[model samples]
Each structure stands twice: as structure tokens, then as C-alpha cells.
Target: MTESDGERRPAGELEASVLAALWSAGNPMSAAQVRAAIPQPLARTTVATLLIRLHEKGVVGRSPAARGFLYFPVADSHGLTARRMHQELDQDHDRSTVLARFVEGLGPDDEAELRRLLEGGGQ
Candidate 1:
């Protein structure tokens, strides 16, 4: 079904798809270029709008090009994941509880990395 047929996607899903397009390109792309790259049959205007939103969110960077602008991912997958995680953790007033829960959910390797980072070994 099409988007007009009541198929609404979550905000993050669209944002992630846009990011994936940019990431896969591995080079800066204009809004039009991005629109062409995505598999979804989205409107060119819709892709442009999403790129603008991602730019405003600081997840994408843009630079002036010939008649338009070129957009690129500001961070790779891991960096973006860390950014979102930090953003969520920062929103809670109870830092200890939030952090404790986050740590509790980490796997062994992730927990070890966290410990190393906390001890100033990892960066």
C-alpha cells in the first residue's frame, strides 16, 4: 500500500532510511540525488523535506553546491547510535537510574568496553 493508503511509518524509520541512503552513497549528494537513491517511491519534495529535517537535527551536514546543496551524513552508524543513546539518557532526571538500567542491558563485550572507557582506556 502507498503512504496515502494510511501506511504511516514511524518518524525514526523515515529518518533512518534517509540516513542509510546517504551512508550508502559514501559521498555528498544533492536532495535530488538522495531521492533517486532511495528504493521507496517517495516524492522528490518529500525527500527534500526529510533531508532538511535531518540537517536541522544535526544528523546530516550540507554544503552549497552549484544550483543546489549537497548533503552528507554527519556521523557513521556507530556514532549516530551513540548520539541517540546519549540523547535519551540525558532526557531523564534520574541519571543514576537511567545509567544503571542502560548498563544492566549491555552484553559482556559492551560492558567491558564501557568499563574500559570509564577507566580512561577506551575512547
Candidate 2:
């Protein structure tokens, strides 16, 4: 659906939506710009506040712009996913067990890719 014609997303979906918009823009954007990129109608203030929250979470960076700030993602989607995975891994006491479980759950393709990376194969 277009930005002007979509149902209100559920809780926590807003952050993901906002982040996706930032990633797609490929540059810092003001709250107004972000609102425009989003697929749902969102208030300027709402976007501003969401950006601020993301900034606090270290997911986004902001700098002084015209009147407020231009916000950008601190990491791309892959980097963010890796960071989150590492964060979760760090939370557990049994690191080996956690990693083993994770490895065990990987599909064949992902398992092969992981092995290749472990073996220092760039391709």
C-alpha cells in the first residue's frame, strides 16, 4: 500500500519500518523525509521521536540539519543483524552450548556458507 493508504502497524513494527526506510534512502534524512518514505501516515513529531529513540539505541545517527537533524542508519541490515546476534550470544553464560545449538539449527546452505567462512574462503 502507499504511504497515504495503509493500516496502522502494530507495536514495534514502526521502528523496523522506519529503519527500513532509512536503509532504502541510502542517506541521512530528516524526520519529514522519513515520514514521506514510510508506507503509512505518520506524524512529523512521531517520526522525530522514533528517530531519537533509535539514536539512543545506537541504531541510528543524527546531525544538525536545517532546523532539526538528519538521521541515518549506523549499520546496514546485515551489520545490524550480526550485531544483534553477537549481543544475544554475549548474554548467555554457556557460549559454546549456545553456538553449538545455533550451528545445529542452520540449514544446509547456511551451514556450508558458515563452514566456508570459517575456512577463510572469501568466495
Candidate 3:
């Protein structure tokens, strides 16, 4: 979906939170432990489902444990955000169209500033 047209999905929230919890923990944690980190009382099965979703998204890693899967975030939030940003930029098909739309939307002063930056006049 286009960035403007795409609304946030429940799966996205769950995925983000699972990553956050793992980031805060800084270690692999069991499903129950991850669920406890979440604000709400989530069923272990629910967290497991979210974990699976994250794993599919390439944002989390899983390992087998005695009682259940141990989960960890594959990267920190900033790294993940950078990946998403890179994906969005890479997905744009027409480079000229992207630049045209970007410049067209800028105000006069902003446009001038961007020009200067592109010309290596601004640091």
C-alpha cells in the first residue's frame, strides 16, 4: 500500500511491541516473559502468534527452549526503522517522479534551501 493510504494494522503494533520488549530485555525471553513485558495480559498463544509474525518479517529470531520458543529482536529499533525507510525509498519505481513530487511540495524557501544543499552549498 502507498504510505499515505496504509493505515496501521494490529499485526504491526504487536510486531513493534514484541520487538520493543525484546530490545528492552536485551536477551532471549520465553513467550510468557515477553507477554508480561506487554502492558496488557496477552495469552501465551497470542504472543506466540505475534512472534511468528515478527519472525516472518525478519525482525525477530526464535530458538527452542524447554517450555517454548525463546525470542529476540534481530536488530534495534533504529536499525529496523532504517530498513523500513530504505525499503520504501527503494520501492519507488521512478526516481525523477519522486524528486519532482518532493520538490513540487516544498515551499519557496524550502525549495531554495534544498537546492543549496544539493549544490553542496549547505552542510
Models 1 onward score TM values of: 0.83, 0.85, 0.67
TM-score-wise, the better of 2 and 3 is: 2
User: Tens digits of per-residue lDDT for model 2 on 84-103?
Assistant: 99999999999999999999
Over 16-117, each residue of candidate 3 has an lDDT whose tens digit, in order, gives 777778999989998889899987556789988888888888888889999878988888888898788667768899877876886799999999898898
TM-score for predicted model 1 compared with the true structure:
0.83
In candidate 3, stretches whose alpha carbon ends up further than 4 angstroms from where it belongs are 1-9, 95-123
Off by over 4 Å in 2: 1-8
The lDDT per prediction is: 0.90, 0.92, 0.83
Model 2 worst lDDT run, 10 consecutive residues: 3-12
**lDDT of candidate 1 over 17-88, digit per residue (tens):** 889999999999998888888877788888889999999989999999996789999999999989988999
Q: Which candidate, 1 or 2, has the higher lDDT? A: 2
**Positional deviation of 115 in candidate 2, in angstroms?**
0.5
Clashing pairs for model 1 are none
Q: Where is model 3 poorest over a 10-residue stretch in terms of lDDT? A: 4-13
